[model samples]
Target: MRLFLLAAIAVLSTLRVAMADSAIGFKQTELPADAGGHALTISLWYPAAPLGKTETVGENAAFYGLEVQPDAPFLTGSRPLVLMSHGFGGSWRNLNWIAGALVRQGFVVAAPDHKGESFTEADATEIVPLWERPRDISRTLTALLDHDDLAGGIDRGRIAVIGHSLGGWTAMELAGARYSADLALKDCNRAKLPPQCKAPRLLGKVGIVGDGKADPRLAMDWRDARIRAVVALDLGPAAGFLPETLQQVEVPVLVLAAGVETPEIAAIKADSDYIARHLPGATTVYREIPDASHFSFMQICKPNGEKIVEELSPGEGFVCRDGGGRDRAALHAQISEAILDFLKVDMR
Candidate 1:
């Protein structure tokens, strides 16, 4: 028993040392309504100076968190900025893992818990107004540029955007892809209620689901020229964008499709495949991660994570699950490497 205790203590001591050595700094703040027409809750991660307390970011009952220094001073000198948006019913925490990885690569990352559509505030009426999501990213960029401490450190010309699932749709829009609500509904009508059409009856909720009279705002161009490149992961609602608009996107784009298929996940052919086909060949690149599922891009789950999610919301534990008995950490590493490589080449 004494030997076992000593071994446990040694293991914990090593973990503490590793956590203390993390180079990532994390900070969470609320930007006022004046900045985005509604209050925005955001998390920022960046390279840190060698000081401050190490704490886990995004820890919860179901998902594991990454260690980071809270409110640590950022490493000086300009660094590129990468803005992230989470999938439907997700918060900034959903992509916190990648944010930490990007920080280690000398990039500043910011993710906003989008108003109305975020995990805490999801509502059919609110989410139907999808244009608000891209606006949220723009407002976040504005806030960062106006921030006294962050402004000087952000390399404006090197800005890029990365997003997963619904957030992927948002990233494409900001990169100059114009949405076509009619096309979205047409695609939905053909498919057997693809994942995006399931919850909240996003299409039917607006009373335009069957009639095809989509909200005009859904067709608006939400492009933000500051985003020099875009990386979209397993994007849903991909059929909604006009092909011409996609071809017009001058910036480089990397579209990654998850390999595994599931009822709850978006279809590769209708979404990711469609984007790859329509996007300008010269500026767009597509890759599929064979071992990944739609949920694989999310944070790693705890050992009992699936059970915990099932208890909270029956049949919804897939968020805590992955495909083919694959390792989440390894998948994360693969994803981060792909993104870093893409950014390194394209952001130049």
Candidate 2:
């Protein structure tokens, strides 16, 4: 009886070890570019069997210098790839929780920090064009598809993209969706700006207000045709242009809106509604978490931290109750589960 109990315990421990060993990492190589010298700091999280050689990439390192995990298990051959982009002024590391969770569930996750954005400083004089960020994603996908080490191990055809805030707009654009011109017009009207300035600018300062059409040309290059699904979290509304851009989207979309009262939450809901109504052939799923806030989707604020949550949400106070009573770690796990479930249906 004693021997059987010991054997059972050993088996359980080994299984746990095997689960931990299922992921590996690899380095990200900068892509050669003629325009603005594009550079991407990326990390890959995939399935693996436990060999102690693999190191978990830290957030800062993954966002700056490319870091890789090695010897990860490639469950049932090459796994599906999910490319994630962070919001403006946000680092790719913001999505690490989700990425790690997905990797554990047998998916290859690639996340890139957009140049001139993220934690890296951008030229203050020249604001990086919002339209160009999505191109970074497209370029990274191309690189991953071509890389020898990941070539046969990745299912290029079963690719997905997930984004948050401004990143959400990029995902929608990549799906060939257009936004309403009226949305932009309303903002410009409210600004008391001259009617003539309402015309969409080809290139200019892009803001949530008075610049809806700024990213008019932001959309996936159908010629490349790699991604199949998209998920946008806490996306804000369009400002300067018309509805034509979002109308072109044809892929399946999942929009996660945290709450409606807050500015950030309101923005996400508006974007989700626009996509759900306008995109033809689009199967849109919109979910609203009762007590979640925009910051809840990321690790930006925490209950145990130095009152970042209170500083951000003055009215609600610093209690974690406002954020569904789930701490940062739990929130991340919930988000990962939601995202993976969505992908399982859409990607397959």
Candidate 3:
């Protein structure tokens, strides 16, 4: 019996090594100037022939990175495409962990760094006007479908989107949720303003309101019909979304909110619930992750990551924090499982 048990353990170890040998393919590409004249940097992760040397990608002193075969040949046959959007002030690396999980499940994930909102750059003009966010994803899809190497491997019919924070708002817009500057201003004017509305803006701006009716860009429809499914992670500025547009969304949406609520921010009920109420009951699903925080959706941090982050940039170490003592990897696994299950139902 002891010999048999030892043999079984050896076999399992070999299987694990085999699985690790098959690595995800990762590469970075640049897109031409978008409509707003901003160059977009995109990161793609997909199934590739297991041939190249595996190296750690997206790693920094503060965060752990995923081991992938960089620039490997694309795997044969078409596969589903998933576009990811990072939160404000974040880059494509924020969703790197989730991208790897999806790629392991036979998916092609593309994430673009929004011009001004990205970590590399910050411009009030581009950041203030949120309508441009959805357009970025749309342009990314169009460009990829005609690309030299990836266009043939993308299953355009099974395209979906995953976004966190402001990215979540972007996904909503792409899912047909229209923005209303007037509504947003009204919410900002209330006795208790939303955290985003209360925060000081760059360029000496106080709030997002400035002649809401006259500013046509504030209410433009930025919906992308090609997006079949959407997964929004703790989206904000929910008050700005027009109820009628939410009800009109034809694409399926899976809204996952953080279980732990922050005091300074509005409750999840006000944001996720408000949007869920207006969405078509048959197509929308809202789920809250227990013991997870807004930043929990980001990439996993290394041991002593918070200390390193604080040393580098004080008061910003909160990026490495999560609800309670929950393991970030466990949280990420749960989140990825939920997303894959949800997409499986809709991405058919």
Candidate 4:
């Protein structure tokens, strides 16, 4: 009887491990570009049974891609495809926690390291040409959806996008479906910068053409892409085009704001509120995670990081001024669940 009890316990543990392992399969590939011989590294996370193969790709490449852990489990074939983009100076790995959680819930997540940005401080100044990065995303999607390996694995008709900071801005622009020139001009004036901006102007440009549209560029068309939903997290101050351009967005949007008390936070709120009020066919939801800082959503927080311990205390990760004694995993889980829930209603 003792031997039988022990055998049963061992079997249960093994089954649990096997169940977890069956959910996800991870792989990395370098996607070649047509222009200037440039290439982008893309990481693909997909649904798989416990018996699927798992391989490790080492060392997180900040400006490139990182492999998803082989042991992660994903619900098989019930979920849709999600494409994620990282914030400025963030590598594809910065959002691993979010990606991993999404995969576990059955999403096939594809994250690309933008052409020029990554995790290191040295690459901090290397912002990819604004429009170029979004184009990269579009192309990457084309590749993923068309690839032999992933062809039928994803539900192309039900796709969603999530971005952080700059990436958030990209997601918003993609959903707006069209651009407006007047909106760009207003963003420049708000920043108190001169109008009639030229190329590479970070402050006053009407679209992504110049310095990446702090004024918000509305000078182009979006080619009527089929993205069904968008979520932007912790985006910066208005560029000229956001207000006018946002009105053109035809799908639902959710904006998550951080650091409400700070000047930057205030600016972001203003922009977010403006979009919520004006965007057509858009239902916007805004929430603030108290004491959370700009970088809290990413994996940059140290053990005693200011934003980590105080604002989010007793929730996720260490204790600090932002929040104390917060569990990072729990916070991430909430974020992942929120995203999944949003997609379920909006993407369907």
Candidate 5:
């Protein structure tokens, strides 16, 4: 219901000092789904008993220079569960910094590698089923709360989901959004369409829109009752949802968008605005990060990341680089604090 200005300035001022004494240890584990889900390699950060070992945690192999204490014993205390969803073509390590900070603040954080969207997939089908992203979160939550090795000391009632980009769309869907085919067609038809939007339009031109409920998953209900709150970071294309559909979303939501304008980002910014105004029961706080781009929400690049990106794609810019003299670490710390604050109020 309000815009928070100079938000990062305030959050970072206090967070810097508080984090000096917070828990910075974590336990990394992998879990396989029983059926109908992707295999997950997740990271768990918690207040811990010193294990005397440190492991580098960043974009694995590519940018693993941020050293962290791994496999440390869990902190003894009641802690809420926070499930993190990465953006398309991203890895769980993209949000490792945020997860580490959340654990330091008395919350157990878990970031899962979503099917199709993760970096390991080798084919197109591995990444195109965007409809299943929310289900992937739901399945992972189930694994955390009910599966033996994975389920322990989790405060089920105080659960929350944090997602970025495509994962943001996933979080909204799980927060009780129902898709409308009609609105989807209309949004895709908007001026200055992005690459993803253009695909559906091309398909429609060939009369491939198909029959009503043709793709049952298009309008499927994927909301998980246990998700008490959601935090969407620079949410991706959301034309599939209308304000009326989002009215069904009753949980608290905090939607954040980057302050850059491009053909690709313009649509996403609009989606964030609509979601902020429409999600019914949420005491929504719509904020924009000054001087940030879409990739700003992901991991802070390592010292050699620019060279690495260039080597991978010649003549292309480092996709993860932030513009306008912004420090990725500072920006991340600010957002992480905001998330903790919002969840503390609503999850209580």
Candidate 6:
């Protein structure tokens, strides 16, 4: 335990925020779900007074970054809006690094904690319907656009979204990729699907269940037209997408995948590779992090993560640890730069 503590401290020291020279605004606000089921909390990072102070996000079990004035007024100019979505079982805090980076780059970032799959909320009904993920984003967009304080500063015509793993799939759907049960079964199977894929499980709650093949309800349109482009990071559930609908996508897309062969990458490799080729979008780039893991795309673990892990469950800290001896902080820097570069050209 002595050695472990020392090692954990060293790892934490390496991620010392590198001391940002500029400040980006950050705030968390709850928005009522349009469905009126579960309320949604959105973590927003945008341009603000560049105070050099630092603050922890959430409980700091996951990450810590630049501090933002609480509910700071929007920066004086119009900026593209970038909606953020975390992976299943993750909170907006998962993408703090990316959100902070984008907000500094003059783009507004809002990440909604999908109630059922997020850190604080878990429910079979809210999480089971795959379509609900994109719908969450769509509803949030509407609310953001209508909010008196936010509407004027947003570039309604220039909207982009970034999401990791399950959120990556959500980004695709929001970017106009529809779901087709038949097309999905070709390369996806029940055994490989996540628990959220269990439609019967959700159907049973609503007193609706069909014969064994698949819940026909899975074949519905969840795409949101407001998303002009997307950056999908290590997406999962290859079978949930319909190629016919994916072919219909015409926006810019950047698909980043983890190169390592862990279960995380295994879960999304098919879908990532397929979208790289299938997103008929005029501009598309698929880049694999040579030695990175899927979770490496997320913020590095908090320095005290070891203690936090002891308090949480086993798989809780699994994504926090990356293989290949990669520096998680350094990786976040690179990924942030890569994404900003992509958005620079695509979003413009």
Among these predictions, the greatest lDDT belongs to 1
**By TM-score, is 4 or 6 better?**
6
lDDT tens digits, residue span 47-102, model 3: 77798589988899999999989898876666678999888778888999999997
Give the TM-score comparing model 6 with the true structure, all chains together: 0.81
Q: For model 5, how many clashes?
A: 1
Off by over 4 Å in 6: 1-22, 35-37, 50-54, 59-62, 122-128, 186-217, 303-307
**Tens-place lDDT digits, model 4, residues 1-348:** 122111345653554454465455676688877773357788777756565455434232121123344644444343467788887656666676677666665567888888657634355455665555566677778887777465225666667788887777667766753344445444453555532332234433213444333323234454327677787777643444445556656667767665434432335555555555666643666666655655556653444454434454344232122333355555555566667656655421
The residue-by-residue lDDT of candidate 6 on 1-348, one tens digit each, is 122111344543432332233357677778864554557777777776555555656546446655565565555656678898888777787787787777666677888888766656646235545666777788788888888474237777778889898899889888778765545444235466653345445434322333334455555666777777789998876565677777778777889987775753454666788788787645787898877788898777777774576577665556666766668888787788778767656422
Superposition-based RMSD of candidate 2 using all C-alpha atoms, in angstroms: 8.5
What is candidate 4's TM-score against the reference?
0.70
List all candidate RMSDs to the true structure.
9.1, 8.5, 7.2, 9.7, 5.3, 9.4
Cα lDDT of all candidates, in order? Answer: 0.78, 0.59, 0.77, 0.57, 0.68, 0.69
Against the true structure, candidate 1 has what lDDT?
Answer: 0.78
lDDT of 5 by residue, 32-55 (tens): 665765576676666665556777
Model 4 residue runs over 4 Å out of place are: 1-21, 35-37, 51-79, 120-124, 150-152, 177-218, 242-244, 259-266, 300-327
**How many steric overlaps are in each model, in order?**
0, 38, 0, 43, 1, 0
Residue 98 error, candidate 1, Å: 0.1
- How does model 3 fare in lDDT? 0.77
Candidate ordering by lDDT (highest first)? 1, 3, 6, 5, 2, 4
Q: Which residue pairs collide in model 5, if any?
A: 116-126
lDDT per residue as tens, model 1, 1-348: 122111345653553354454488888888788843678788899877767468897888999998988888876666689999998878888899999887776678999887666555645237535777898899999889888475237867778999999899899989989887666666456556755445436665532455667667767788998888899999987776899998888888889888888876657535999898988887777998887899999999999999998998798998876677669898898889888777766521
Off by over 4 Å in 3: 1-22, 34-36, 121-128, 200-207, 210-214, 263-269
* Model 5 alpha-carbon miss at residue 138, Å: 1.4
In order of appearance, the predictions have TM-scores of: 0.87, 0.73, 0.87, 0.70, 0.83, 0.81
Error of 4 at 83 (Å): 0.4
Candidate 4: deviation at residue 250, Å?
Answer: 1.5
lDDT of 6 at 6: 15
Native-referenced Cα lDDT, model 2: 0.59
